[model samples]
Target: MDDSSPPEPTGDGHYERLSLPGSEFSPLDALVALVRERGLFVLVAGGVVLLGTAYALAAPSRYTATSTVVREAQSEPEGIPSTLPSIPGLNIDPGNAGRTGLAPSAYPNLLTSREVRLAVARDTFYFPETGRRTTFVKHVNQSPGAVELLIDYTVRLPWTLMEGLGRLFRDADRRLGASGARSPLLAPSEEEQRALDALEKKVSASTQGTGALGGESGLMVVSTTAADPTLAARLNASFIEHLRRRVREIRTQNTMEHLKFVRQRLAEAGRELERAEDSLAQFLERNRSVIAGGGAPTLSFRRDRLQRQVRFKEQLYGQLQKKLTQTRLRLQRQQPVITVAEQPTPPPEPSAPNRSLIIVLSVLLGGAAGAAAVYFRSVLASAEAQESGREKLEEIRGSLTAEEIVQGVREELGRT
Candidate 1:
């Protein structure tokens, strides 16, 4: 029962573990064990650290550029006060009282939408790597570096094999009279799609300080990442520009159509008014003496009818003129104005691949891995010293297979 005595071996092919109090545990023994296997520990730890350092140096640098914008917030109009007496002819449009323009909350989604991305993809940018200005599509489809090519081929190996097999089967089926379906008309070409995908991954948007109690704050930040700092800044700026254009178009689309309609009607009304005036003038001139003489009741009646028609046309034209003015005002009000709070500038330093942090984490991880390996080796050696433990260990080694090891690795990666 002495504190330094080892625990007795149990019948279950394991040593008995005593439930010692916290004060009885000593860290010095663990330190001594690690020092005893210093050679193995240094080999594992040093190798891991070297690999991490190499990765830190070899990884590509990424720069993130950001632009901030503040959108004008529209609030609902107040209803008529109870103290004010309602007028019989005065009317208020309920639709006009509420916000009809683009909402601030939708800025992030709009920036990330397919339309904006496609528009950005069509823009030309300067790529430092190629030392030439080219469209985004061409840049995305450019030749890959040796390392990139290797990674791309390795990652896509399974998919490539599957696709080949699929084509073979499909050809056989075609010979058996199974026809393939037609491709969709709206699908994009492979090059264009690659550019769009690249934009989707690199460009992003977020909102900040959205009002108290879940209200919209109207502040937005758009960001883009690229290998080159200037390119990153350019991409960020392009996203903001296209996003503004799209927002304005969507906000004023209905109002612009309405304005066009109103103008057409106003023009028609003016023509109708002019025709009525001409008919009245001609009728008066043709029967000037007769009208002055008041001799023919029929002629006087015709003059009166023509005069009334002219007055009616004048009134219609006036109403349409007022409607045209009101529509112009509404269109102006519905237009969205995005104010740029902060312009994107070329980043002075890379925003990714923090080498120092990577090195620190690598060191910690390597040391921990080394410690675990040392402890496991010691325990394993002790277990092999006994007859029952040797037999049990042999059984375990015999039971393990390559397939199970691969499955276990896959499961661990999935969890990670």
Candidate 2:
């Protein structure tokens, strides 16, 4: 063998290291080879670990603020039962009888709804990191840091290029010109939509319970993640506020509609009562002597009928008045949809970029990479001694080249 070539195994167990004619080298032999080349493995692994640490330090920190809430059911009147007296045009069927606005499972969906997201987006917030007051959309679209920009140009180049090209082809005149006067009924602007999308990912709601056979324990958690701890807490609070407001609106819709109906009916009953009273008053005025004394049967019968009609109208008017009062009371009794069980607070530590784990994984990957690289280099060096193997190595290098592939793509796009 040439002095530059690797020596064949020649230890007492070298015979065991040799494989059968048709088989590959044993795993034990590979392990022995890696052990012999520990220097290269350590160098690569250490470099990879150092890179991981750098990445962890440079990456944006994410702080998650969480708020725990309990779903509060709407309370019934003190003396009221599950069912109420049926009315002619009013539906007394209890709307959301046991719970508040919607099921606990539906809260996640409600928190992500367009209405809630838009409201939160338009609201002004104070960001301590920037020491500026800005809307959610502006805060979300703030310029990135140097590391973020570098990542966007490197690892995220494909996605970044796509976004850039999309913007280039977009109708800027239509979007920015006076012709962009969007109707009040139109969807949100592009920036608002992007902010809303970010909100969808950053803000989240989840329901948790003991999983009892009975029912849900009515516990929910709302969380918001951001680069700034205080901002995360503030965003969580905003999400909770909007979520509660939405729930209140949904829960009270039925009661409000019923209140309107009651008011209208009460007015009609009052009018009816007035007409009946007037008719009874006129009849008694005309037949005062006949009613007081024993008069004709027909006249007495007419008098009795008029008095009964007046009484009936009076009863109906009183009932409606009572209903109106009760409905108003119920509206007042409507409790808040959610009660804050645990207030949101800024987290001290970051929730992401586990540097230790990243470093550990990087070390392992680099070691494997280095071992495979060393093994392949030795095999190729040995193979180069044969003409056939040398030709195959050249073929592999030519196939791996990227210049031709890039040129072909450019040509294709030019033709298009």
User: 317-394 in candidate 2: lDDT tens per residue?
Assistant: 776777777778777784676888999999999888687787778778777778776676557755675687789999
**TM-score computed on alpha carbons, candidate 2:** 0.72
TM-score of 1: 0.66
What lDDT does candidate 2 reach at residue 290? 78
* Alpha-carbon lDDT, every model: 0.75, 0.74
lDDT of model number 1: 0.75
Tens-digit per-residue lDDT, 1-416, candidate 1: 76566556678755432222235545764575577678779988988898789878878899999988886664422332212232222243323422245677888998998788888888999999889999998988888888777755775578657756765665566456534653322344557666776789898887786565135656788889999999999999999999888887775676676677767877877888899999999998899997798799999989899998888778777766665666666555543467788999999999999999889988998999898877777667656767877899997886588876777788889952
Q: Candidate 2: where are CA atoms >4 Å away?
A: 1-24, 35-47, 79-83, 88-101, 158-186, 211-217, 271-314, 378-416
Task: Give the number of the best model, judged by TM-score.
Answer: 2
Residue 125, candidate 2: alpha-carbon lDDT: 82
